[model samples]
Target: MATSSGAPAARTFFGHPWGLATLFFTEMWERFSFYGLRAILVLFLIAPPADSGLGMAEGTAKALLGVYMAMVYFVALPGGWIADRVLGARRAVLAGGVVIMLGHLSMAIPGGAGFVYLGLLLIIVGTGLLKPNISTMVGKLYQGQPDARRDSAFSIFYMGINIGSLAPFVVGYLGEEINWHLGFGAAAVGMALGLVQYLLGARHLAGVGDRPGDPLTPAERGRVLRIAGTVAAVAAAVLLIFAALGRLTVDGVTVALTVLAIVVPAAYFAFMFRSPEVSAEERVRLRAYVWLFLAAALFWMIFDQAAGPLNIFAQRSVDLNVFGWQMPASWTQNINPILIICFAAVFAWLWVRLGDRVSTPQKFAFALVMCGLSFVVMSVASNAAAGGARVSLLWLIAVYLLQTLGELSLSPVGLSVTTRLAPRAYASQMMGVWFLATAAGDAVGGQVARLQEPWGDVRYFLLLGACTMAGGVVMFLFTRSLRRLMGEERRAVPSAV
Candidate 1:
């Protein structure tokens, strides 16, 4: 292991730096805590009070979950700002770990809805602090490495993600089959274990994320704080006013957050473009990123539904009877993770072998195609289920399989490319920008998914499926321009049309 003096990490763990191993397990546990709770969250929400659940309405619960997921990622902009200007990425990650552990522990308590809401609030803030910064550190670890190697490294990193995602199976089992609080406790324990190991491994990450990349001057700090404080106060006042008027419903809050998810990013993009700090070359790349970001947002809108309407559908429509034994519906959540584990490495190797022969836009196009096809298949399944049939679990499995392939295509590549296109001044913040795509997708997707009630599942699935496929076609048309924009002054970018 390297020391805290910021020496270069020894190349280990299949030619990548030793820091990757430290970060890898840390992320593994984080994902365990995150996905484990998520797997059973909707189930717990819809579960009656008699069953020790919150008993929220299905539409409301799903909306809440979608909005919650979006907000968690949406707040990453500030999280990245905190890292860039105040805490430093390393300390931000540590602070985030502690906060997340506490959040899970809070949820573990058997008490009123306040505890649950408080826990979720903490988790959202904590994840904002951790997720983007940790990924930024991963990119930092590969400073001076080839783009292909970095891309492969991200895929390997994503493997850790999928490995952690496997927790849903165990956590869901405990929550659904036993006590929900106990399941929350298990997630807390997982985060605790991750934190302990992270502390021990800190030395390996010494040079990386050790201090703020762009520390604020004392004058700048004071000005920013004043603005931030004012904004927070006004936001809180509005929320209080809404509550007083009895307009503070879950649906209302969800809709509000969803609108922010759209507007905030638009405003942020304008800020970045005008910030004299962004070089003209960086501006060109950012323009290319706008296109990619839109594609990614669409991809996530479909992919994230795995735990929302999709999870609900699995419970209600899919056959759980196997060998005359019923499996927990949440187990269906594991299929994508399982597939990710099995194939992410294969795709990583394939990308490495191909190098920049294929452009990132082309990859995204393929991913959209896969996403669309998955939904198309899902439409068929939903139709059968609506016709009063407990369709075979294989139907759902196939959807996950297609989605897992699409995820490998877009998610890791998106991470790698965001780091590449980012201006030097906005390094960590750029990672936050990447997560905003997910926030936008989930926010819009949540509202779009609610249409299933009025339009029926078949129509809802087919509509999204067809639209996404059209997005893939449009993506292909822009690949040549995107590649040229990305390749300026670069040796080997993702390549051409």
Candidate 2:
């Protein structure tokens, strides 16, 4: 096992065994913690209050689901900032794991809206710190060979996500079937297990995520503290204002997220345009990245539905009848991870075989199409259920299988592309920006899902299908230009688009 030092050895995993294994489990547990909570979150929201759940109205629940999910992704911006400028990836992951443990533990508490929201806030912050930074550790694992084990590593890594996701759905079924708190408590336990493994494995992961700053100068230290304080204050003010204005309510959350969808990107753009640090080429790339953001957001609008609208679709419309038995609706959440574990290898092979023939922009175009097509499956299912009969559960499963394949092509690959194309200094922030794009997608999905209540399910699914398809079309139109904008820049550049 070749250990990671100041620079990684230009060697294969066969040449550096421990490095790969270390990255694998660290990422796995993180995903386990993350996806487990996601499995039952919406169901928890929509579960009847008498059942010891949130008992939110369906449409409102969908919106809040979107808001909460969006806010979760929104944290990546600051998480990336703290990692790059302060804590470094390793410490960030450690801190994030602790926070996640606390968050999950909080959820284990019974009763009260305040506790529930506080737990969620903590989880969001923890995920922000964990998600992007953990991936950074994997990158650090193989310093010189960016492409060597990249796809395989992500494939293995995302499998962890699926495993985590699947465990939760199973736990949710048992817990909700037995006791609600049981499921929440089970999720907390998963985080604890992950944290223990991480701590035990710390020595093997030496030198991976330390911050670049040696002893910080007084001015630099002061600047960082001030900026962090300001950002925190701004975040607090926004939350309070939303609370005061009723934006945190089920009715207001969707609107609040929509506003944030506009605000965060606009703010980032303003920063980009004003920053004297960026060169003309970097500015142009940022514009390209913006377009990429819009395109990817459309993709997520459809893809993220797996948790919110899609889960509901399964609950309300999909039949689980098999051998005279019925399955819980939340169980459908397991499909993506299952399929991801199965198909990740196949997609990785395809990407390897295709190599640079299909450009990143082109791959993104395909992702948008697949997302639209998944929605088309849901539309068909929705139509099938129009006569008040449940569509076959197979429909939901098939759609998720397809969506997972699409995600394999786009989501993880998109992260790789961002790290490759973005300037070095902004790598973490660019990753955050990528997540911000997803935040928009999630918010859009929520708003679009709300249309189901008024427009009917068929129209709702159809709308998502149409928008995603249009995004795919637009991406195709700009494929050449986007590739040009990405340039031939290496991943080591200091700032990202």
Candidate 3:
């Protein structure tokens, strides 16, 4: 590793290191591919087979979407470890990009449902490798810079994320209005572009993400490689057997993934809490994180459904007319990203301006409340649909705007807090635990979305909205207790988003 003094000091983009720009664009294009797929996935899954879809039931499609999203995050645990102990972040990212491109190409091929399944699996694995390591590299870029600059760099990086997120509109339109394969091909092109730029800008990365954080000894390396190879072979064989038996149904996979999502996080918590390596103070912080984790899960359960029930609602109920042009339903998914790009700076400014007036727990409470209000807005729209009226697209936009505000309050802060509270020996593990919250949420969210078809839209939206509001109220009441558990060290945690 290069020492701070030995590192290049020249400012390149917006007073940050040149590497920030590299990571920024790389992440931007990656997210473009990711969100573009997300915007069209459920639509493609549920559309008629004659229309280039699988013709899966809405409930089944939502369940699969949820499972797929959960697996994408869940795999990051091993993915991060792989980067730390085997492949360096740079190589992992390159390999992951190649896999993602291949995934998109597979989806673009005109074939049966098998192609979709194969594409999703590849994308999930590729995302697992790319997502966490890229964020780690961004942090590495500001390693020796002033502490304040780290937050700014992350803010810039997030803008890149939203910039990439904007692609869903174009890609979704192509997928929904034109041909699904074209949209998938566009996503492949996006990843290709990102990979090309990453290669070109490799020099800017310098000492960042170039080597494993924890290199293994020769003996340890041999043991790990042997174990990993064995595990991979066993997994492949088991999957093949399952597929051959015709037992690999979507529902079966969803149920299995949901169980893993719950069990893995529970096991992680137990291990961390019981470990002698964790000090008493660290244990208290971990307990606080449990509450934070649950809060995040609830928030995501509602937010992530944008691609499931909410996407369906937009297509079925909302009149997407803007200036005499009918828009594709997937275009509605773009609202949240646009809001994030527009207001991320404002939220950052608000946090700084509020200073000591706000606490982490308070911010979380606010997020939950905002999320509940978003659902409440949706409930109203649902009621309008029940009354046989097509609501304005503004209703869905309002819901997305409110949810984006909640995301700004919570998501980045959650990441910062997870890092701050992590034990030195288990930093990456703690980050994985944080991601598990998202996995759990998506898994549960999928199951919840399944109820939408049977329960009717009005009742379903109202029920979810009421439950989320109650959760926010409970979190608000527990805020002081959570703050106490965080102790004085909570003051050091920086707000992000």
Candidate 4:
């Protein structure tokens, strides 16, 4: 509705802009498709061929899962660039949703590994285009709004994510207990519904995410395409040569990607440190961010295994039999989201009530300690299951509860800290860097999970858990220094609440 001055009046959905509602549902469905597929990805890989599965080695399957998870984030940087430069965030989101639906459909076909790989590739590409830009759109919705309102809007948006993420228990059950292809198809339908909702709500999204923030000139666009084509051709040629030499195996590809994910981010940080664009104070903050980044990576490396080694552990070691019924192992992935929904508000209230009493580094220290303890508990469970006895379902539930605490401590705080510490010139890119921490961590975790094949699960849980607690202790030592670097005024601004 137009105001008296021929300008559109601000419309609100539950007190925020109406546009937020559109973006919120879009993101919800996107996450629904993503978490749904992830819930069953490993299960389908290791299931017996006679059970219509791939019959892949457990190590290979896990490594692939890690690489796939890493690639989703790693690819998002370029994806966001493309959305900002060419398609605009809105169109990119629509295109991405369509592509994701297609990806799920591809996997649903009753072919072999080839179609599954094709599906995964499509999902990655679609997600790359869609995931980051939608959040960008959310930010756009509150262009001139105060920080507190923006934060509240995001809280509402975040609830959509957790709500969507709960699809795994529902979709995952069908995939595990009924038919795997059916589950994939259901994910596709979820995306389709998201697209439908997005289209219907497009009228509400006018003046946001509708144009490139920094569009390239036509000549620049051509140059970019040529460069991209050349890079792709050369990379493909190299892969073909390796394929002919029989060295282009899955492990080889995963190793190369892992190296790429870790090394590129490290090199970027080094360049940023030396750049004249960064002031001395900014550089000091960047140094602090470096520590935080490592802490975040360490946190995610353990946390993200919910779909890989942890899932396998639940399948092999947890008694899925409930009272009189047998529960699907994939349903285990739903616990964290359930906990998040139940307690996200309580955690927020605690942070608000505590105010700045807790520093960012201190919160991260808490996360590391709790993450370590979760695995320590898992280590005990692993030992108990050593002789092929299934432990009670409460064991995995306990681990997820601890990790959820760790996640609430770190995830939102990590974002707030990164935004606070980023240099002005590279403010947006630093958000991508925050995701890079996850990619690097997941890539490394993939490689680490491979050790389970040689070292076994009990030792794996015990050793990593011990090391993580040590990491927490080290972070606590540096807490005062990091708080100083973030600036005294920032310290007084209260915690991320």
Q: Largest lDDT belongs to which candidate?
A: 4
What lDDT score is found at residue 96 in candidate 4?
Answer: 94
List TM-score per model, in order: 0.89, 0.87, 0.93, 0.95
- In terms of lDDT, model 3 sits at 0.88
Instruction: For candidate 3, give the lDDT of residue 272.
Output: 85
Instruction: Give the least accurate 10-residue stretch of model 4, judged by summed lDDT.
Output: 488-497
Give lDDT per model, in order.
0.88, 0.75, 0.88, 0.90
Per-residue C-alpha lDDT of model 4 across residues 304-334, encoded as one tens digit per residue: 8889988988888899988888888888999
Sliding window of 10 residues with minimal summed lDDT for model 2:
488-497
Q: Is candidate 1 or candidate 4 better by lDDT?
A: 4
Better of 2 and 3 by TM-score: 3
Candidate 3 local lDDT, 155-239, one digit each (tens): 8898899899988787898999999999999999999999999999999898788889898889998998899899999878977
Q: Model 1: per-residue lDDT, tens digit, 267-372?
A: 9889999999999989988999989999999999989998988898888899999899888888898998888778866997899888877778989999999999
CA displacement after TM-score superposition, residue 274 of candidate 2 (Å) = 4.4
Model 4, global lDDT: 0.90
Candidate 1: where are CA atoms >4 Å away? 1-19, 139-156, 279-282, 353-357, 423-428, 481-497
By lDDT, the better pick of 2 and 3 is 3
